[model samples]
Target: MATSTLLLHPVRLRIVQSMLGHAQTTTRELAERLGDVAPATLYRHVAALVDGGVIEVVSETRVRGASERSLRLNLSRASVDPDDEALVDDERVRAGFLAYLASLASAFDDYLAAPRSTLEADLVGFRQVAVFATDDEWREVAATIRDALLPLIERSERPEGARRRILGTVSLPVD
Candidate 1:
């Protein structure tokens, strides 16, 4: 499975977020999806993802006299090993969680960049919290979170649609 890369910086994370669940995309298309990302940076991150196996070139064709490669997420190389204790460490997990936060924020920023005032937010809200719990209860709590949100995430799926907009946050300090 693909461990998140040391090179999976902000831009690359955005690229992957755009590419999720898709069959493939050309460099130009990816750049368009990732508005404000330079073509060169897109290509660089795509190459890194290819190396990382987070994405694979499903096909390559010459488009407009330039090489255009189609890309898709490769599940074969995508996962976080739950048993890997390092992934559970406070520092490493915090970094991974931060990466997730960056991805979610980037996705929002990209959507807002779209030329559509046609969209309206029917509701907007926020929550703040500090959770303290025993280790034995942590697994159950995590399970509750997944069970609660997975269906909400599923509701946003639309055929032939761009990725849905959903934000999630999870943080628990080691006290």
Candidate 2:
């Protein structure tokens, strides 16, 4: 049972989060979406993800005379457990969590920067928050949230039109 926090360093976290829900991405696509991450730096992070078994090479295609590599995550095995808790305490994990969050923020910021008009309903994002009861309350709330979002993902696996690639992360805070 691998701990997600042990697996998710700042750079590795960004790469995994970005690659989630997408069909596949080449090293170049990842570098571009990640922003300001030099290819060498991004490649190192990507390699780490590959080594961790969080992300795996899915396809090879030719682009500009180069063999472009595509990678995707192994969803069934992707999770953080108590043993996966790499931090000494809540404070340390929070710091890494904040850094992990900022990368997600940057990804969305870059998305909004794309050439598109606000009239497009598909080109939008939103957030919601709720306070819970006991630790069990928090756990149930988290499970409910995952339930709500998972249908769309399962739908994407069916033979359908081109699926829209997206990334998602759920934060379940506990003390």
Write down the lDDT of every candidate, Cα atoms only: 0.67, 0.70
Badly placed stretches (over 4 Å) of model 1 are 6-8, 21-23, 76-100, 110-125, 129-132, 144-163
Worst 10 residues of 2 by lDDT: 1-10
| Lowest summed lDDT window (length 10), candidate 1 | 117-126
Record all residue pairs in model 1 with backbone atoms less than 3 Å apart, i.e. clashing.
2-77, 24-71, 25-71
Could you tell me how far off, in angstroms, the CA of residue 55 lies in candidate 2 after the best superposition?
A: 0.5
How would you encode candidate 2's per-residue C-alpha lDDT over 14-66 as one tens digit per residue? 77777776767788888887777788888877777677777789988899998
TM-score of each: 0.65, 0.72
Give the Cα error of residue 38 in candidate 1, in Å.
2.2
Error of 1 at 83 (Å): 6.5
Against the true structure, candidate 2 has what lDDT? 0.70
